[model samples]
Target: MRGTLVLISLALVVAGVVLLRSKRPAWYWMTFGALVALVRIAFTYNSVMEACGLTVPPSRLRLMLARMARREVPPDRPPRLLRTRVTRTGLVLRLGLRPGQDAFDVAASTDRLRHSFRAYGVTSRELRAGVVELRMTGYDVLKRVQMPAKTERDVMRVPVALRDDGSIQYRDYRQIPHALNLGATQSGKSVYQRNLVKELAPQRVALVGIDCKQAVELAPLARRFSALADNPDDAVLLLEALVGRMVSTFHVIRREQRISADIPDAEITADIWGLPDKLRPVPVVVVIDEVAELALWANTMEKKRRDRIITALVRLAQLGRAAGIYLEVCGQRFGSELGDGITMLRAQLTGRTSHRVNDEASAKMAFGDISPDAVLSVQAISAERPGTAIVGDYSGGWYRTRTPHTTLRQAVTTCNDTAYLTPDLPELAAFRPVLPPLTPAGPPSLIKPRPRPVTE
Candidate 1:
């Protein structure tokens, strides 16, 4: 007994030292968890089975796993634990599946696993053939925003937000040339766009904005924008100007594709990146806020104007990648209700994000093609969770993510700071509205009173 007392005291001292040295809260939780583990181990096979939600006369093989885990070692059968890995987030137990058991069985039991382990959440993924991985989140990771540090220097890839799994969510403009972002009002959709622009501002790319809502969203960042269109008329002109630039860029690419006497035929290419640095045209990112506005029209004349704008955007989305132009189309609702060609434009937007939408229909508009589960997930995002969203791509791998709250002032400052980086596109310059240079305020006209006194 005296020896055991000494051992306990020594263990306490070691734990104290370790906790002092570690910065993460996992250490503190694990110290208490060690005590809980002792109590958990004392539970009988029946009790463990009941706690794991297998009380209703579960299969023999399932009980075998339970007993084996508790070292009960059933007289009839025993399952094996190949390996166990404990991470800061959760534990991974690798167990051999029985004849009828599969990864789906494990996945289906995630809720029960969470309850049994007293974890916040539990998820399972197939590691390989016949092997499954259960990833449990240690805490409510989405409660606090996980801001991504600026690391990517390439204009083609920007770290826009953080995933619930602690991975950086990258908006790779190179891979996904067009994206569809949907969110209801106050659903944190605008915050995600702010984060995207904040990251893109420092890169070598021209920014064009179309905000039919009187530029309330994108106007503040005009210093960094190469073109700004707040009305449909201007939007039409701006889009046409972009199409003109696309044609010019294609011409440049085609001209550069010619093989020189010194160069091999294998080196010939058609993309903008293939061209030499001096000859290469600048990459452009066009942001359209409330794309539904551009698709909706009342009369024939308005319909014609709207059609022109929509057609331009569709063509850009379909053929802009090779020409170094990308689109980030955002809206509250985007569906057949908008108008014709909207579906085709949405089809081109491979990257989709749906925030806390107002209705299930909006969620379906964003994610129905990808996964019905994704649509359900997005629709469930509560209004309280503003920045939370369901983000997915054409790859069909979707996940819940959240962007940190970036204020309008922060976004404006980012653009102002990086305003010098806006690339000059000759075709776009004609459509870009000119603003007078900033002149510092002088003390309110000291000489203005002299003219007024003479008139009096």
Candidate 2:
């Protein structure tokens, strides 16, 4: 009877795990997955390290002692595991490297450690001189993105997506002044832009949009845009106006440059952020929905216009950051094939996010210079996963990221709610979109229905 009861309990436990794995993966990881990973790491760490060549030869003292005792020599020593932290999404293992071992050695063997620990993913970073941190995700975070309850958010930094390692992927303009976002049709590139706009709506920064697709993508959030252009001609004017604004902001910073030998070098002002808050110009984020539209031209006159637009873009990208202006250039594909100045403009964009592209060359346009591994990762993105992307930057690091599914209506609502926060920049006042007046709700009927109607 006891044996039968034991079998029944084991079956029940297995069934529960199967159900949780499909229905509530986070819960399952917190309860069962983490426990199993911890146990596996404890049991197989030494063997895995030895197999991966991550183990170090025994010390001379140990060898001498073994010889003196007339016993077999001790095995090589693996890195000492200092601590193991269990997080909501994964485990963080901190290891102290043995002499002559370094973080790169562990990084090279991350795949072995991942398989040994039975974790979904593993990543390593040097914490200090002799310590390295291994971040292991307990499950496939991109499969069903659930953004954590709290994220690191600040001025000009917004967490727009979740990385496959269960960390938030922030769109930080302060760190990377410009970004190139690429994706084919139906690849959720628009959705990613919406999330960025929604996140920026409540901030004090100014939003400038140049959506040459008849403003189909950005017009819904017109209430929050300080300056918007829906055509190439208008976009050129808008870009010129932004250049003017950037110049004016530079003058302001110069005027406020109270540089003195008494002040520390760090305190000396250079950018808008260094100026006093009252004297600082509001930051501007230029979002271009389709860069190809501005680059494509046939006629000589049209070619001149395209050159003007590209020139303006190149100027902004080359020198806009210090003047409180940043660029978010999005397109289906961006390459030298577009025009003479396309590659020059791309060089200035340090951040890159590539969704499902039609070809490897398109992926290369985004990640080729950054990381070859990222290019491969982007190519592996399936058509079924619209929001999944490979995000990277000049830092030479990349991650698989997926933005949570945000509907257009939700983004529009957020923009409307935060419309009042839009800054009025006098430089581009002419380009500010004129939104229709809101229809007022009618007043309640003053006269009550006749009692005879109720009787009938």
Q: What is the lDDT of residue 359 in candidate 2?
A: 97
lDDT of 2 by residue, 28-64 (tens): 9998988888888888889988988998999999999
> What's the true lDDT of residue 88 in model 2?
86
Q: What is the lDDT of residue 239 in candidate 2?
A: 94
Best candidate according to lDDT = 2
Q: By how many angstroms RMSD does model 1 differ from the true structure?
A: 10.1
Q: List per-candidate RMSD values in Å.
A: 10.1, 6.8
List candidate 2 stretches off by more than 4 Å.
1-9, 262-266, 439-456
